[model samples]
Target: MIIRREHAGDRPEILAVVKAAFPEPVEAKLLRELFASREYIPELSLVAESDRGEILGHVITTRGWIGAEKSLGLGPIAVQPEYQNQGVGSALMNATIEQANKMGESTLVLLGSTDYYPRFGFVPADSMGITSPDPSWGSHFMALPLAAHKPGLHGQFKYSEPFNAL
Candidate 1:
């Protein structure tokens, strides 16, 4: 398996995987909105592929705010039904995360399963004094400060307009 930046041509396959991974329309709709929005940075989007060139999973990073501070947000990481639990999600995540670090991002935020995210270094957003616009999420919203010595961000996150479209 391999992980790499997704090209424009890969959108269809990426969406297919999202549909298979999550049957709900919400995640798929979010994917489309993010792709069409100005906040979408192609370089930060990634996919997992097999050695045979089959697209197996995807992950997207988009512009989001922590209070007034700007940072990246990871979401909608999906693997095809047949590929679930095969580390495809992890591969895509590690790749995009490494890229964000290389690009000097201050942090990465996510809203994910509380049980799954900690393996990737995510701590409860509330613990970091970070809050999301939706209070119902409680501890499910999370953040990981990427840069050492970087002052922590503490404020309500403003997700990109595309997120609102969902």
Candidate 2:
């Protein structure tokens, strides 16, 4: 298996993997909107491919804001049903984090499984002074401070505009 940045030609396969990973179409629909939104960061969109060149999973982090400071919003990371628990999601996540660090990003935030994301060094957002757009998310809303993280980077997190429509 291989992990790499997503290409324009990978759209169909990415969407298919996302749709198959979830029971509802909400995530897939959100991905479509993110792709067309200005907040879409091409470099942050990544995919995991099998040795046979089949797409196995997908992950994306779009431009967002932490108060007035720039940040990243990670989401819709999905692996095909058969690919779950096989480290595909982990590979995509590690790649995303490495790339974000390479790009000098401050932080990456997301609403994800507490069990899974913690393994990636994600901690409760509020603990880092970052508040979720929805208070109801509580601890599930997490943040991973990157190599460029600073002590003063905190405030209400505002996800990309397309996320507001959800």
Candidate 3:
């Protein structure tokens, strides 16, 4: 299996993988919208592929602002249904974080399962002074600093336009 950055030709396959992995259209729609916008960071969108060259999973990071601090936010990491629990998602996630770090993004935030993200070093935003618009989801929102010993980053996280529309 190969973990690599997405190329121009990978767009359709990436969307197909997301559509197949998720039940809601919101995930797929947001992907398209983000790609269309100039804000899309090509280097942060990645896919995990099989040894035979099939995309097994995908992850995307986009421009986001947390109060006065600039950051990257991860989303819609979808592994093929048959490939779930097989480490494909984890591989993609690890690669994504590394790529984001290379791009100089200090932090990565997301709205996801609390149980799942903690394994990747993500913790509640409140611990870092980050707030979500939906108070009910405060605990589910997570953040991780790319650099372990960096200065504290704190603020209210404002998701991308596509996320806000949903």
- Candidate with top TM-score is 2
- 2 or 3, which is superior by TM-score? 2
lDDT of each: 0.85, 0.95, 0.85
Clashing pairs in 3: none
- lDDT (10s digit) by residue, model 3, range 40-130: 8888888898889999988988888887778877897999899999999899889988888777787888999987999999999888788
lDDT of 2: 0.95
Clashing pairs in 2: none
Task: Work out how many backbone clashes candidate 3 has.
Answer: 0
Where model 2 places Cα greater than 4 Å from the true spot, the runs are none
- Model 1, 38-61: lDDT tens per residue? 889888888888889999999999
lDDT winner, 2 or 3: 2
Q: Give the candidates in order of TM-score, highest first.
A: 2, 1, 3
Worst window of 10 by summed lDDT in candidate 1: 145-154
Model 1, residue pairs in steric clash: none
lDDT of 2 at 124: 99
- Write the residue-wise lDDT of candidate 2 on 1-166 in tens digits: 9888898899999999999999999999999999999999989999998889999999999999999999999998999999799898899999999999999999999998899999999999999999999999999999999999998897999999889999
